[model samples]
Target: MTAHGLVIGKFYPLHAGHLGLVRFAASESAALTVIVLGTVFESGSHERRADWLRAELAAAGAELGHVEVLAVRCDAPEEYGTEIAWVANVAIMRAALAAAGRPAPTAVFSSEPYGVELAARFGAEHRAYDVAREGHPISGTAIRADLAGRWSEVAPAARLDLATRVIVTGAESTGTTTLTTALVDHYRANGFAAMPVVPEYGRDFTYELHAETEERLGREVAMDDLVWLPEHFARIAERQNELEDAAAMACPLVIADTDAFATELWERRYLGATSDETHRFGTDRLPPRDVYLVTDHVGVPFFQDGWRDGEHIRADMNGWFVDELTRRDASWVLLRGAPEERLRYAVRLIDALWARNATFASPPWRSSPPSVE
Candidate 1:
């Protein structure tokens, strides 16, 4: 007879400690049934936690049949501690497992003393590990207290909220791309293996559209040509943020080339107007990043990239970027001076941020949107 193992929790923002329990269960049992019981009070989404578990378990060294993640929603686990309430909780877990074709677990694995009682409910053996938490030395409660301070404690698949995004924004001819690449290389070389470069979607989309026009009509199109259209901008801005969000989920530290806010400034340059639809789509529709480093067009060589509108447009756009960022009271750092100097400054800023976060004990995440500054 095989010991079918079971582990249950919110895995609420599953941390390293939870991983330890999962690893232990997988090793001891023939099959490990992970039941993620989520209430309305959990920090992360139930779906996200479930998805994170699936990704992790699939990657973990376990037989295909030995590990499984199941999401089962129930009453708030904290709302009651009565004996009957636990009986009810056990009933819900048992029903869901049975419905999914899992045998009542032969062993219940947990770090809490309640495991003894929980196992008794099913007449299963109580197997507890790390009840003292001496190895991992961290808890989900500690994570809730300081998400930034404990970012690495967050599991890989559930790490989007902990992501630190550094956006490089500037007008044409500026060193945005160069600085973005440098920063990405720096972050990756040190650690942060999943660092991503979210390139400007507007440019890519417009470039493709421009190319198609030239091929079809035999007349070349440019960036300014499409700026007057609100629909094009709105589409670009919305998708731009989506790309950032997706990248952040993987990296936990993203280096963006440009963002939707830059798209708005670009639109203002060519259309001689701003799009209300674009503004909201950029600001309201997406998760905001923590830092925006604006590169200066001056002290850098200017060259037309087949799509650029030259020095005059570049100058005007630079002013617009600064003016708008100020008017909106958005957080941003202006990078000037030599290329090497600029890169060093950016590196120092991020380096210092992480250094501070290393000791930071306050929570970085909240129920609402977080700011850059």
Candidate 2:
């Protein structure tokens, strides 16, 4: 008789430790069913965990031969040491199997102690997996608490929440977008898939303003107009935050051209006061970024395309950024000199950060990336 096995977990972030138990059961059983039990009050959404679990199972390939992954939104009642939770969980399992025309599990497998008790209720055998945490010694809790320091423990789907976001920002014509786009390409070519680029939302939004004002009105937008007219910045901030967060899920490092904070700075400079809605949105909604690279405007060629501001505004805003960073004592570094020089210098800083926190399980990018100089 072929053994049908079951494994259950919250998979809060679905680290390697959970994968080990799933893989172990796969090797031991003829067919395995993995249950990702989620509640209304879990850290990650049920839909997200379901998607991540499905991806991992498919990626498991022949190593986990016949397998299925299931996600349930069943909320086990909160009662310490009560069978209410266990009973509820078992009911879901039985109902799920029956609904699929499969039999009740012949064996229950798990890395935790509950497997024995769970299996007993179904009159099935219990097989304890790596209860000692021998193979992959990591936990979702540990991953959640210190995500930057524990990047390798998380699945790709969970990375958006845990990955380090490096914001490249400065005044127009400072090569901010150039560096951001280049870094993403460099990482992908060098074997880091999650290095998605969050293109400059503010820059794109500003271009629209310039087009409308300069072409239609046939006049350049004055500083007073930007400062006093407050609505557009708010929309840009919300959009920028969305774009950055969306890009974070696929890669370990998010290389943003500029984040909302940079947008806020420009709003402060051009508009005396930013819209309250946009300011609060950036402050409360956006996650804390890992670092900032502000490109220096000194000696850089300032091109005045029909849409761009003059070199004077670019230079003045760059000084304001430097001053603000000094006041806040934030995590930041200056990218100065030629294009090639700036790229190389910024990569070196990021490379050091990657090395210090790397766990060797996450993909590596330590080799020298192609230099432009």
Candidate 3:
């Protein structure tokens, strides 16, 4: 069937405001041409915006079969006047429709002032839908602002799937705990599920091996150098295995405070010079992490107690940990800057990765099980 009307806009996210226009056009026309204009611009990628718009329309109960979402590229001169720019856009839209073997639309739908003029140029019926009155209008400006923490609002149908697991690593007194807590808060506040690593080894082994030490050796010795010894490495490894197994069984998205690889770094640093056995035990142990995040030494002045090491060693150890993780062929993201700013950057990176993963609909082989002859 031929398209009865055409709708044009960037539709960066196709939120509730855009839904009103689509519903209005659907009532007047048998089929609507949802032309996604200026798709080739660098501001917002066409494929990214198109996918979001498609999902939004589908959720709004619009018929995918009758709704045509077209991505048209326009390259008009920068010095051109508004009238000339409109003419250029019209030419591009007409060509796009002709290439798709569809007739020109009878009416045009838009909420912008330019919509009326574009409709007149195409000799099509003009209809304006009020975006501000309808509800939340999803624009790039508003989305970016929300991300920057100016507002606590997000799109109702916003995709909150963070596919990658974030693993934070550092020795004690390096602000690892602070960073993990901050990340969890940031993600959870933004409507994503983030699980924190509880370090079962410290509690489990403490009760088993160090339980008696706490009574005999006292709190200072038990909490200090003894916990960093080679004998305790086995319990640490076991705890790490438990966490990894649980994460693998649970969800693909997780945030771990410290992984087994980081534990290995501690073993090498604390163990004596001739402790080859301890090094071998740590090397053979530990599971692979998807992405390892290392924090920089910006002199943030972290608190240190009797059990904690100096900032110099902590900073040096962080560098060695990153190098070792890299040598093991594990992907890593180095987080720098202030605590909140770093958290924001990490969240944005995770969001972008998740969005990319979502873009891949499905593979051909996965569509159906192996066909029998």
Candidate 4:
């Protein structure tokens, strides 16, 4: 007979341990339902945890099609492992399963001792794994205490949501790519194997579009011959954001040559001014940037890459970046002087950004204070 398994947890910030347990459950049953229990006081949202599990399952080739992720909220004041908490928690879990049109689970999988009671309440068998956390040797509590230090414990998808996104943006030929690569190298050289650098998608898009247009006309076309449209920029901006987001999820730190937010300025530069639609597609949809490392054009010579407009516009674009980043109250640093000096300052800024973002929000519950005399 086939068995349906159930696993429940807050997964306040889903970690590798949770993934291992879920995988174990999937192995023991034909189908598995993982409930992400959440409370308002938790730092991370329940829905986001569900999304992470789904992404993880998709990536786990063996368990891809059999696992289901669901979200349920429980704010019962009763402490876990108590009779009252069991009764309350079980009821909520049942209601959630019913609302999702799922049947009572045949087996319950967990890393906690309460799995026995939880399974008993649902007339299911308890299959516990790693009650002592010997395998993963990690917990949400420990991870919360030092999220940055314990980053490897976080699930891949959750890492993206919590990672610091640093965008290197400035005018054309201002060494944005150079600085981005340097940052990635700095981190990877120090043992961060997962550091991903997202290249500027807009540049590729522009090149491809120009090539196609030239092909249709059966003639070589100058960059100036290309036409600009709001929709074109909108597509570029959306794709840029997509690239950055994918990189963020893959690693703890994302260094992008340019990003959707910077696309807005490019739109203005090419089209005289940004259209409302361009902003909506680009800057308006930006994920929270930890910081932007802007390359200054003051001392840097602009190289006329075939696609570049000209050297004259470099200073203008640099100024626009500063003004716009300031208007949005965004954290940014201007990188000037030699390439090595620029990289040193960029590293310092990124280290600071990592330190700041590494701090996690404390969970709501607090330990009891010493009794007063």
Could you say which candidate leads in TM-score? Answer: 4
> Per-residue lDDT of 197-275 in model 1, one digit per residue for the tens?
6888887887777877778778766656542477788888888888887787666677888888887776676666669
* Candidate 1 Cα errors over 4 Å, as ranges: 1-111, 114-158, 220-228, 357-373
What are the models' TM-scores? 0.60, 0.57, 0.48, 0.69
Model 3 spans > 4 angstroms off: 1-3, 39-41, 60-65, 77-82, 131-140, 144-146, 149-178, 182-331, 334-373
**Looking at candidate 1, what is the lDDT of residue 218?**
82
Residue pairs with backbone atoms closer than 3 Å in model 2 (clashes):
194-250, 194-251, 227-271
Clashes of 3: 0
lDDT ranking, high to low:
4, 1, 2, 3
Q: After superposition, how far is residue 5 of candidate 4 from its true place, in Å?
A: 8.7
RMSD of 1: 9.7
- In candidate 1, position 138 carries an lDDT of 75
After superposing candidate 2 on the true structure, give the runs of residues whose Cα lies further than 4 Å from its correct spot. 1-114, 117-157, 210-228, 360-373
Candidate 4 lDDT tens digits, 1-373: 2379998887757888888898888888888888987767656677877888888888877645788889877676545537875787689989999999888999998877667877899999988888777998888777777665677788877877788888899988888888888888988886567777698988888999899989989999999889889888889888888888887766677888988878888888888888787798665677767888998888777688688889998888889999999998998888888889998988887888777766655335433200000
Model 3, span 8-108: residue lDDT tens: 76554344556667767777778887776543333445555556667667766735447777776655432224666567667888898898777888888
Model 2 residue 189 distance off true place after TM-score fit, in angstroms: 1.1
Displacement of the residue 213 alpha carbon in candidate 4, Å: 3.2
> Which residues of candidate 4, in runs, are more than 4 Å off?
1-7, 16-109, 117-156, 275-277, 283-285, 359-373
lDDT of 3 at 305: 59
Best-matching candidate per lDDT: 4
